[model samples]
Target chain A: MKISHAICLSAALATAPGLAFAQDFEAALKARQGQFRIMALNLGVLGGMAKGEVAYDAALAELAAENLETISELHQAPLWPEGSDNMAIDGTRALPSIWDDRADFLAKWDAFGKAAEQLEEVADEGQSALGPAVGAVGKACGACHDAHRQPSS
Target chain B: MTGGQRLSSDDLSAAAGDGDAAAAEQVFWAAGCASCHAAPEAEGDALLTLAGGQRFPSDFGTFVAPNISTDQQVGIGGWSFEDFATALRNGVSPQGRHYYPAFPYPSYAHMTDADIADLWAFMRTLPADQTPSAGHELSFPFSIRRSVAVWKWMNLDDEFVLGAADTESLARGRYLVEALSHCAECHTPRNAFGGLVKGRWMGGAPNPSGKGSIPNITPGALDWSATDIAYYLGTGFTPDYDSAGGHMARVVQNLARLPDGDRQAIAAYLKALPPVAPLDGGG
Candidate 1:
């Protein structure tokens, strides 16, 4: 009885990591997509205000800007693990190029973060300056998407 | 006005070369002449020197821009206005040889005689460089200039590729975009023979630079409003505060040179385009 209990415990310990790793991968994928969706939603609000499609409200703009700035600051590097690319997983548009060119990807991400910070800083500048600030942020996002993210319909 | 006959190509060329510099300058930027004709790294006043040695990479191969500066030997300086008109409207070199479509003359074919003359006049003012342009590096079947004749036969038409614009603003936008800027050359999809796939106009396609795909600007793909589009053209930023980069960064610089109204017009036109779902990745 003592030998059987020891064997069972050892086997459970041996196989546990593999099962946990699979779950971790799925969670990472969900986190990655979730982050992008949040970013897009925040961007859309800011975009509408910038284009005058939606009336400029300082409070709303600041909120959107804050959201974007926070998202940009998030530690997203872990979300893009090796097998998270579209080639490795379904429902993903992250190209393998992101992994292949990790340094460039990080640089672009840094640029985006800087742009987001700029947006956050200028959010209170009212309608006049916000348009251009928002544009800067959009361009930074586009720069990363152009090189790293695969386009989806 | 002799016998009410149209002015000869020589007469038009001479008159145009002496025409209003300011108006011609507007056409110069509107037509994006400096983007290709200017030296690759040229900036400031050097952009006015159309020495022409830019390399455009495509699926077929790399194409080197030719000298259009007023150098008598190596450039079009010595050519008559008719020569210039022929090159723009027909994609034929002054020597009667077929020019590669890389010059964007297919769209230029729809340009008015007045705009052509104005543009030709402006080209004559540029400082000429004596250097001969570099050769194109294309695959066997593509390397032959005569082969372009066949391609032109199938693709080249004098009529507007898209339908006529309904409103006056739309018309202006269409003229600037379709004829002068030729945005579709990069934005639209291409067929197996490297011809523009008309149905997918402005749908965005793979980057010929082999980096990634271009974004779809049609309403279906891009959600930016007219103001946003104009802001982007003038400032190189998306409505969401992303700045334009890559080749488009250069294009935005050129567009920024235009007047505010012109950029607005372009934005209006983009907003008016029919929505098209992106067929593949990369917008």
Candidate 2:
């Protein structure tokens, strides 16, 4: 009976609404941030090449663009479960509007994906083509950020 | 000039003639009309439509951007050049009522008659939206329209904050930052009366919307090279590859449309500024 009581106590703790949700979303938030860091790293490489800050290499540009395209296509739904917004969670800049305006958010995600695909297709062609492609991707990033993310103080 | 004063009849006659639309297009972009007048979240060509329902919340009240589109019935399309000039430079409406400073005419008040006329001409060319203007929501005393004249009397001036520009680029940058872009409107801190604290020129301020603080662009605070500043202005990308977010993204969209040299000029001007620390740092 003591062992059964201990088991029930553990189960109750695990199912507690506030504690459980916070623990679950902490991991999701970390993963989401990690994914964005990776994207930024690859985007930096492509951006450097386009800006001529780094020598243009057809192979390197292709690799960076492909990485971005792959990441953009990932199914990120699980990472953005409800109640994980900045209003409910600290240290995250994802505003509550992302959940309130889910349709618009998803559309922006799709637009970013399309822009990444276009960037990948033309990245290896030449630096001239890469310039505009990178700009389009940058604009797509800004569009969503303007609507969904909080500004850095 | 007193509040509610219209342009003189001579000035009105001068502005009545056809303005140089080509030149005005530059003024349109420089003045950043679309940043507030365009529909919120608008992108690309849609930004040119001055439908104006964006709401700005402040300590006093929520100020709604009114429709400045060329719609004859709902917008300023039917207003004479004198009316438009007065509104832009004098902070008075066509109805002889004083306008709130949220419209940023305090900066535009320094605009030359030629630039104002040109801006009017360029505005006339844009597509008109049928949307009606929205009234501002304000608290008492502040809600009283007549109270603005007192605020105007205390704060309004056409003086340039910086001394004479030694170089042509510096001159251009001063015009853009001071009169056209009105960068200080956000970057400079304000007193309890909402007047800009001229002593702390480019020092950062509490974001009037109460979200975050606007950064200090003085040389002491922003250490980015001129090229970095210009590049960031054009592409919205920082040196670290982090993109500009929030309202600055819209600012980038407008600046990108300008000639490359204009961005460089702005960079040069910023670099030449005396460094002023942010107020929170005990400035």
Candidate 3:
């Protein structure tokens, strides 16, 4: 019983509470996390494929590529999870500058998301493309994390 | 120098005093200053910024390189020679404030007394600093002076020294790359408390500037020829002909000016390091 892209997209549409045009950030952040998780998985699976390093290579690659496409779609659709707990953890590799500079982080994230989409273009070519594709993804991760995410000191 | 043998303090002072410039020179050579702060070619375009570069990036943020030249106003012109030595030996400023370990004072503290003096002697002769030093913008707990002193007292040593070297070339290389150049502090990623994760030596992290990842240079040699690595350090162009960009551009410029042998030796040592596990592996 393979769930098709139509069904997955439909699931996203139907699950939303309403206000299709509404920027209900809480829902958007939830949605975006889902997307990044999928994208991360996409890179992982493709990396695995490049090395021929795992079982179920074809299946994993297919699922990963598919997720990569969806993740790219949802990029920038979520940020700053609304109504989220503010229990801030200390000793964060995160610098105080980020909170002070939200606009810059968002702008960089937007650019990062766009570059991430290019990964799908390379990835769609097939597993042989993964090693370089991952490099592209690594660049995006670095660019954003440099501006936003704290290094795990 | 490893195997727990350090020159006696008196031997080092005596070497400098007795005008045995060779022993004094050996100490200076071992400390790794010529690795970066080179004497200007008499071409009249003296390279005034004898310090490593205009800026260095770390887990915290980017720090600008200070002018090491003996120039009085712009550089440490007002200081006694001993003041300069204390900065290197104890990671303190000429003003007696904490010198951040970002200067690699953690490893440099291992330098012996005589070696430090010679290095200072060498620094005094540098093209004097025209580059004004940038003050750091550290956060609250970090900005405090006493805490830095405590960090120095505990985590840093004041002795001019290094961890014992084993193989001679390897020892020489380590002295240059690690202690003197403070390569590991940047090239290696840090743990949560901002300490170098030793096992991952030279495994680069995203520079604190939030610009780009300095590619892991431990396994970095495999991606290029030894000459290519040396050449890039010397000239900024990889063998691929692609120029290294961003913050590394400055580092390459500094490296390019170094003595040829120093560049080659550093490359050889970096190439020989064990490849650490990559952190970005997909699940």
Candidate 4:
């Protein structure tokens, strides 16, 4: 009876780690991927307006605005889940320093979230605000990257 | 993780002793410049060949690296020997414009004059196909290089050479680390104007390379020994399972080809230099 119980305990312990592993890094990657997709699609909507390639559709514009807000809200959270090792999810490249300096890394994310939120508010206002919205969004991209991104070759 | 991570600083005891131009070229090639610059076709995450196009995504936005090949119409082909030396020594271009230190001129500046000559000769020998190197797409104050000069004047001294009190080996290391290599430009943090924030030397910078952070590499890396540091420079791996990824692989490749004596000198120089907190942008 003792042996059977020990085996059961050991087996249970072995499976425990597997359960935690179920939290796929892919989920994080796909979320960022989704951000890029939606951001690009929204840009397409804006570009269409600029080029007069498509007639201004209020409904389409509304969708783009919604996407902008969603992305902005998402940006407020950490690009990488706390304790993550993946670089791509963070919308950055590979450099061991990201993991090496935790405080600075987190601070960069915090700054980015603030800028993203501001841009989202502007972007959600509609086509009339595209100029400022683009600038705000661009600024957010720059703010996160300047301090945290790796060097150019 | 620590055991295999760093390469032995002394392992390259067999490095070719001849520091001639040929040897210099050999080091340059071994350093993996071709991996990003010389490829006939651009690939991977890199944006350009030697005509640099690698985009460094930073808090400021994505800054693309410039092509530095000897493309006469488009690259450094027009550069004279002095032009090259000035760029390396001062982190300025032939046109006297301040380079963003993205060229690794800080570390590259530490290379021996002879090695610089060799590199120049080799670069001059590359295909001179002009691919227009564009201006940095920076915002406000950063878009201008003159302002960069003001920043340069504040952050860097006239020239931070090795002190006479340092040993010959230490001097060599300083020369390589500061001038030829300019490792500090990135490995060292900056003040608001982009100068090497005083009191904070090479505790590792926020890796301006558009990738991962470059970590605080003082004795701060508790697991690393002096020998371990040397080995990692020689090999791409560190003592802890971390290998030299990103642009640092090129650094290891360069060190691997350098004379064993020179590599040790570099390590000693690093050890002796005063330590400082690079990015003290307190959270």
Candidate 5:
């Protein structure tokens, strides 16, 4: 019985790393997608105001901008583990170049962070100020997306 | 003015004089010269450098954009007005070689002589980079330069796809799309021979990179309002707030420089297109 128990323990130990890796892949993909979803939600609020699709409320705009800024500041490295690219997994729009060209990728993230900070500063200023700020943030988003993300399906 | 004919100095004499640099700037943006010629990820004034080393990979091969900057040694600076016009209108280089269709001279073939002259003048004013052009890495017969003449013979035509633009805006939009912008080059599906499938006009294709598919922008596929489309062109934001990704971001950068009315005209033209079904699960 002890030998059987030892055998079972060894088997579980052998599979543990592979199982953990699968979980990590799924978790990382979900985390990154969740972050993008949150960013999109907040951007939608600002975009609506900029386009006059919705009435501009200083409070709402400020809140959305702050949310974007806060989210952009998160330690996103954990959500972009090396093998979590679309080539390695399904349901991800993240391209392999994100890993292959990591320095440029990180630089784009920094740009988006700067743009978000700028948006947070000027979002409540007025509709005119908000429009350009929102545009800057959008461009920053695109600057990264253009080179990194897969096209929308 | 044929597909493989080189323009003579006499043929270009009418346009040899100074072109309107101001108007030419508009043509530059419309032609999206910087989209391929500019170094990857170049922005701001760096976009004006036009150093040209972007790589476009397709089934045929990888085509590297040539340096069109004013560097006399490696770029087109030494080429005459006739050389420039012939390359644009006839898909032939000054060296008496046929240029591959990947340059999109097929669409440029429809460009008016004045626009070509204006574009040339604007390009002359830009900064020069001395980067030597990398040749295309094509497969088999495609590697042969002479083979391009056959491809050009089969595919080169200047006919506009849209029959008539009832409105002035539509006419302008048609010119921008069918001639200057070469939107169909990416959005339209291509055949086995790499010729555009005109029947699938604006029907998105599998990306030449073989990653994601290009979206079909025809009226059937794109549900965005004209305002939304124009806004997306200007700001790179979709109606749902998702930003333009991939090569479209570069296109947005170019289109955004145009007047709002131009973006709206493009949107109007897109809306006017017959809804082509997405190319069989491609988009």
Candidate 6:
């Protein structure tokens, strides 16, 4: 995961300047990827319930849905600061489009948040509603990926 | 070897009067044209506007879909039914130029004359857009439209790639998946030059969209029962409870819009396909 350790060491020896910014960018990229992974895991739990792969436990669905809403609505603007794209940071699929089209990217993020909100609202609806609600959230995630996220390598 | 027949404009124009708009609408949905031709983020009635300029980045280059709306000058409005059939069946434009396979005519070549006529009539009912087309952005050799003729010679068989359909569901599934749905365009691996590799049909390949590989649907790879497969098409949920994400989510959206019979037929056909190990890193 440490893609630029050699470059970072060379830069540190060349100049004291820009090292902290580079480190911060690396941390931000890792943090967002980690955030997305956690969201996927949490969503998988709700998805299992929705698909009837796992027993429909209302309590567990609520917990998973709430966790998804929390992660989606969290204020993590710093995690997407410019220069954290795949071009700047290897091992990342965050395309330059995210920074280039900031408004669209943020709007897509908000779309996910709205979908998560809907899921949270309906998590208590048991079997029938949970399936469709989870689907809505999945659609929102895909919409964001389609417009903003680069395809995974 | 049901390569499409060329419908005379007279025949199609007459049939146009008797075309079943309801059935034509089903063909439109099954063909998934809006998946590429419609503007990004288009919804509801906007899906009917065929002002195609969507850019699909590919290994060859970016292929910009042309406007197929009924605008006489920019779209296909002035095209005779024969002209349209020629493009769909033979990958030749009305001007007799070779069309790049990006239009998926290789699969569409199997369409019956009636289906094509129905589609033409249905498209005519949509709003015409005069929007100019943004053509393909390819480099040197690929940019040469004449070269597509050679590529077609090597790749375009225009036959049903699958085995004989023994059952009614299999027959219906064959039409829906092979002729109309064109599942092979992505799910099947292609050779170095981007022609579908028949030997590895539905064995999956590197995602043309550049995501992780598309999943293999061959029996060896996907062991889901027909019922599970149908359910996934309808609801977007995998057997393991994970929801489909990425481009598949859009495919599911379209599949969900289809009738239950269509979904079931797709599943039955998929399950009936010959088993093969994935060619690429397909799951």
> How does each model score on lDDT?
0.77, 0.85, 0.54, 0.54, 0.86, 0.78
Q: Give the fraction of native contacts in model 6.
A: 0.22
TM-score of chain A of each: 0.80, 0.85, 0.55, 0.51, 0.83, 0.84
Model 3 local distance difference test score: 0.54
For candidate 3, what is the DockQ-based docking class?
incorrect
Please state how well chain A of candidate 6 matches the true chain A, as a TM-score.
0.84
**Native contact fraction (fnat) of model 3:** 0.00
lDDT by residue (B1-283, candidate 5, tens digit) is 3878888866664474366777789889889999999987788799998898999999998999999998999998898888999999898889889888889898888888788888888888889898899989999978999988788878887688987789989988998999999999999989989999988899888889887788889987899998889889888999888899888998888887788788888999999998897556646
Q: Which model scores highest in DockQ? A: 5
Measured by lDDT, the strongest candidate is 5
Q: Give per-residue CA lDDT, model 3, range B1-283, as digits (tens).
A: 1111222343344222433444455445444443334332111134434543445445555555555667777667677655655666666666667666666767775555656666665555556656555566566666665676656544553332234446666666766676656676567777765766676777776666665555677763246766657655654434433334443443554454457677778777877788766667310
Q: What are the per-model DockQ values?
A: 0.14, 0.59, 0.02, 0.02, 0.61, 0.24
Writing each residue's lDDT as its tens digit, candidate 3 over A1-153 gives 235644654565677543122233436445644555655556656654553455435555656666655655553524443222122322123344445666765665666566556655665566666655554454444445534454332
The sequence of per-residue lDDT tens digits that candidate 5 reaches over residues A26-56 is 7787888889889989999998888788998
Worst 10 residues of 2 chain B by lDDT: B9-18
User: Which run of 10 residues does model 2 chain A get worst, by summed lDDT?
Assistant: A15-24
Q: Candidate 1 chain B: worst 10 consecutive residues by lDDT?
A: B1-10
Q: Candidate 3, B173: how far from true, in Å?
A: 1.0
Model 6's DockQ score: 0.24
Candidate 1 achieves a global lDDT of: 0.77
Q: Comparing 1 and 2 by lDDT, which wins?
A: 2
Comparing 4 and 6 on DockQ, the stronger one: 6
Sort by DockQ, best first. 5, 2, 6, 1, 3, 4
Interface RMSD of each: 5.1, 1.1, 11.1, 16.1, 1.3, 3.8
